[model samples]
Target: MLALPAAPAAAGDIRATVRDRDGKPVADAVVVAVPSGGATGAGIPPGLAEEDQRNKEFVPYVLPVQAGTRVHFPNNDNIRHHVYSFSPAKTFELPLYSGTPTSPVLFEKPGVVILGCNIHDWMVGYIYVSESPHFAKTGADGKATLGGLPGGDYTLRVWHPRLEGSEQATARPLAVPATGAVDAATTIGLTPDFRARRAPTPGRGGY
Candidate 1:
């Protein structure tokens, strides 16, 4: 019998804790790993198609995809969803969809792309496509561990739907030692509201 090869050890890990100005752990925070060279050798796991429907909502409120990944939209509700965004990451829309679309949505860049259902007005979702495979989403405990990072310099950034500015403006630098652990902590300010709601009743339309 042939012996199996050993799995390669991860070069390093980035353990992090996120908190707000008040020191309370922030939930739904997105942490991104970007190498300085603007290149990556990691392949993303297969992604499933998602839907944002006329029930005035997105099926999955938060999505994490690797850069250059494709996402699909299948309208599953009786109503329609007009998904669009002004975010620099990727700006697109599926005016109103039903069943599987002809093509999936592609995210070429690494950043947070905020989604909105123009028709519903109050529906929103966030798509966070990471540049590095060594990333994880924070759980309710507000902790995330990014393992298998190449031992080198990385520009790490945290993002949230309500984040105040550009992710690049808030990124921090860290060096992942070849064989040790590093704890990184950062605080971010958030906007007052992060909830979805129904649009106000339209006023009497002109005859």
Candidate 2:
């Protein structure tokens, strides 16, 4: 029998754990991996993402997306919300209306975009726009997996809503193999989340 050509090596997964300075599992922490050789902006799919406004809060709390992602801010509450971001990465507003705006906001820059609501001062969210597509968010257990990344050297970094220092301060070099999974761990200092603590609308029971 004739020999068939060898298949290209498959991409792998990068699993990471994030812990606070006190060794507590840090949830909603985003870990991003940028290619060390400066080849990025291709692995990530450019499309749609959502940062929902529900229960007087931004649903995901922390969202990680690649640059060029169009994120929809859908307000599902009975009350209208004025969603806006004053961050240098993205600054825009959806003037007081509910039920998914007609035009989604595009995230064209790579940085930390802090989201907030004018009407509800307690409402807050975060969007981490990564330069590379290889990234993941830590779960309640502080574990996150960046899957399907081709083997290569990467500059790994972590970001959190209340991180104490600049995101760049957590940078570390990583070497990913062409196959199988890699494990990484990072410890960071987090500042207390000082978001306004407003009482939920009488019996509404919200965050």
Total clashes for model 2: 0
What lDDT tens digits, residue by residue, belong to model 1 across residues 165-193?
77677788888866666888879887888
Q: In model 2, which runs have C-alpha deviations exceeding 4 angstroms?
A: 1-8, 200-207
Model 2, 1-207: lDDT tens digits are 999999975787899999998999999999998888777834858789999987788999999998999999888888888888899999998887878899889999999899988778888889999888888999999999998888888889999988888988999999888899999999999997788997555543332
> Which TM-score value belongs to model 2?
0.91
Residue ranges of candidate 1 with Cα displaced over 4 Å: 1-7, 41-55, 194-196, 199-207
- Output the number of the TM-score-best candidate: 2
**lDDT of candidate model 1 versus the reference:** 0.74
| Model 1 poorest 10 in a row by lDDT | 198-207
**Model 1 Cα shift for residue 125 (angstroms):** 1.4
